[model samples]
Every structure is written in structure tokens, then in C-alpha cells.
Target: MQDDLVRRAVEDGDQDAIRAFLADICSLTDMGFAAVARVTEDRWIACQVLDKIEFGLTPGGELAVATTICNEIREHGHAVVFDDASAEPDWRTHPIPILYGFKSYASFPIFLSNGDFYGTLCAIDPARRRIATPQVIATLRAYAAQIATLLEVRSPPTA
Candidate 1:
């Protein structure tokens, strides 16, 4: 199921727009990596990525759902953000950061226009990057909405 959605998102007509969004986000947030992932009940797949720090995941690449915070964001419908995972007393020992070796991270869930959960727009960097500000969250939310709109227009949920 997720494989199909990943394929659709990767091949969607507005892929260029999504790529531009990823690039813009990476640039604005000083993030080394940005990605649009297809999150399912048990898996996470990268449908698009802008990787500048060699995080090593490519389009269609897979990661365990349990290993990514996107899963939590998906379930909770809230963005999970960390300015510095290494400096955050509560999250310093969180498995995602420790396993991925990232000092900063953020993830916003994507949703289709019809209210179906799609995936996530996520970024991570080795250096601590300050985000989670209102402006930043608003920007990420807008981008995620645009991506969702593109997906819905390209492939509406099956009736």
C-alpha cells in the first residue's frame, strides 16, 4: 500500500514543485536533508529527498516505521521538532536521534485533501538548528498542504 503511494508521489506530475519545496526548505532551515516520506502502518519510504549531508537515503528508500518520528507525527497529528537532540534532556536518549546521529530534526505530517493521511515532510541535520517557531511551523504546514493537494489532484482516493 505504501509502495503504491510512494510510487505515485515520486512520479506525480508536480514532482518538480515538490522537489523545489524540499530544496527551499533545506535552504531556509539550514537543514542538510529534507524528504517527503510515505508513512504506512509499519513502514516509512522516501518518496522525495533533498540530501546535502549525505544521510544516504534515496527516493524509494525504506526505513522501519518504528525507527522514525514520522510515525509518531502521523499518529498524533503534530509536528515533532528538536532544536538539538543532543542538548535536549528529554530527547537526548531518544532512539531516533541516537540511531540516526542527528542533533536537530523536525517532521510535519502530510494529509490528502480528503483528510486521508499521506506521509510527512521531514528534515534533519547534524548541527543544532533552531526551528519550531511559529513562522517555521506555518511554512512547513503550508508546504505539506501544497504537497497534499498535488497528490490529491494527481490521484484521489479510490472510491
Candidate 2:
């Protein structure tokens, strides 16, 4: 059933359908912007961006943040959320949002079945939004899992 949904999403080039399907199973969480990025040596490539709403940044800015988050996730190997970038000491001076017009973000690393860190699945908002519930986190994690599965299936097998 899930595979069918995923296949349909891929076939239709429907990023929102993919994200919404995952969110429905997990419960809609975090204002509904999700993306999938592909990690390469020393950098990440933004592959897909899914959103139920629109924001001010251009596609380029979105791609840039996706790449940045992918790199960060590769280094950290976990889920992260910047609820209030302005309040976060570590990120207060980070020119990402100010430069790109994005303010809030949540992301998780997508790992291949072999445990290789491939990239990340993320949600971003131009407003300072908080994902403060365990359910929300769980939902994001589940969506990340689905993304990982998709990546694994799409990637050529390494022999």
C-alpha cells in the first residue's frame, strides 16, 4: 500500500502528494514544508521540495538551505530543529535565514539501508515556528523513514 503511494508520487512528480501521504500516516506536523536532499562528497544537492503553502524565498534559496541542512545532518547524523533562529545563540549570527529570508527549520538525516548517510528530509518555515510535541517529532521521523526508503530504492546498487 505504501509502495503504491510512493510509486504514484514518483510517477506523478507530485512532491506534495508524497509529503502529504507521509504526513497523513504520521499526522500533519510542522506547518507542512518538507524536502529531500541528496548528499555528495562535501556537499548536498536539493532534489525535491514539498509544501502545502508558499513563502518569500526563491527556489534557489530553498535549494541552498536544503544543501546546508543536508551537510549539517551528515555531520550530526540526527534530527534537528531551529525553533527560533534569532534566539539560538549558535545560529543567531548565521546569515542563512537573513540572507535567504527563511527563519525556522527542522531536518533529519536520511540514511541508506546500509547505514550510509545519504542526505536529509526537512521542513522549513519563513516564520519562527516551533515543533514542540513528541507526536510532531515522531511524524517527522516517520516521514524521514519514507524518504530514506525512496532514496534507497532510487539509488543504484553498489557492488
Candidate 3:
């Protein structure tokens, strides 16, 4: 299965823990979709996912890196939170939300312990809901740190 390949790429240590972390993200945020993606300049592959809203992406699903909001997080090394794209003047015509059919979305850049960009921890929902709460953002940032820790534990980058 492709998930096997994806899992091996990110997890040389604990797989269940990472999956549970993603699940915890969705549960805590009330998001229908949560994913840990492995991102590069040219690719965005889902390494783990908790998709309850039928977003149709699996563990190994690939989306164009350039087209996804995760790419923005990757490039800027920042987290984005959109409570409702449809309500925001800046996001109303944004291609990503329109293309993906998600009204509420958030993404945080996942970095390695060595400060290298790894990917993103992102969640989305179709309903227009509040997701920019302090508690949710704090939890998501913590999850990003935890994912980085797992990556480091799996295999630290060579100096």
C-alpha cells in the first residue's frame, strides 16, 4: 500500500503515535480533515491523515505543492488560520479554497529540530467555523513541535 511507503518515509520509529497525534488534532480542533504532509519544493504527499468529511485523500495522496495552501506555509514558515474563507474578503476568491471546497482551513509549518522545513500539519472543514481560537492555535503549534520531535527521533539530518 502507498501508506506503507509514506509511513516508512516519515516513521522509522513510532507510527501509531504519529497517527494518534493527527487524530488528536482533528478532535481538538473540531476539524473534519487533518493531515501531516511531507512537502518538498515540488511535491506534497500526505504522510498521515484523519479525514472524516470525505475529502478523498489517503495517507499517500499527493496534491500539487504549488496549488496547496501548505505550500504557502512551507515557503513562509508560518501558520495560517482561516475561520471561513467565504467570509474573508482576502480569501473569497483565493484559488485554493475554491479549488478544494473548504471554507475553514488552517495549516502550520512542520520543521525539523535542525530548523529545516519538513512539511505541514493542516486541517480543513467545509462548514464555516471558528478555528482561530487561542487554544486551538496553541494545540496545533504544539503538535507541529511534536511532529518535528518524531522526525528527529526517526532520523536526524546529517550535518
What digit string (tens of lDDT, one per residue) describes model 1 on residues 30-143? 999999898888878888899999999888788889999999888998888878998888789888899999998988989876677889999999999987688888898898
**Clashes in model 3: which pairs?**
none
Query: Ten consecutive residues with minimal summed lDDT in candidate 2?
Result: 56-65
Can you give the TM-score per candidate against the true fold? Answer: 0.91, 0.70, 0.90
Residue 128 in model 2: lDDT = 70
Q: What is the C-alpha lDDT of each candidate?
A: 0.85, 0.60, 0.84
Best by lDDT: 1
Clashing residue pair totals per candidate (backbone < 3 A)? 0, 0, 0
Listed per candidate, the RMSD to the true structure in angstroms reads 2.2, 6.5, 2.3
Query: Model 2: clashing residue pairs?
Result: none
Please identify which of the two predictions, 2 or 3, would achieve the higher TM-score against the true structure.
3
Q: Using TM-score as the measure, what is the rank order of every candidate, best first?
A: 1, 3, 2
Better lDDT candidate (1, 2)? 1
Better of 1 and 3 by lDDT: 1
- Give per-residue CA lDDT, model 3, range 13-100, as digits (tens): 2478888987887777788998888888888888778889999987677898889999988888999998999889989999999999
User: lDDT at 98 for candidate 3?
Assistant: 96
Q: How much RMSD separates candidate 1 from the native structure?
A: 2.2
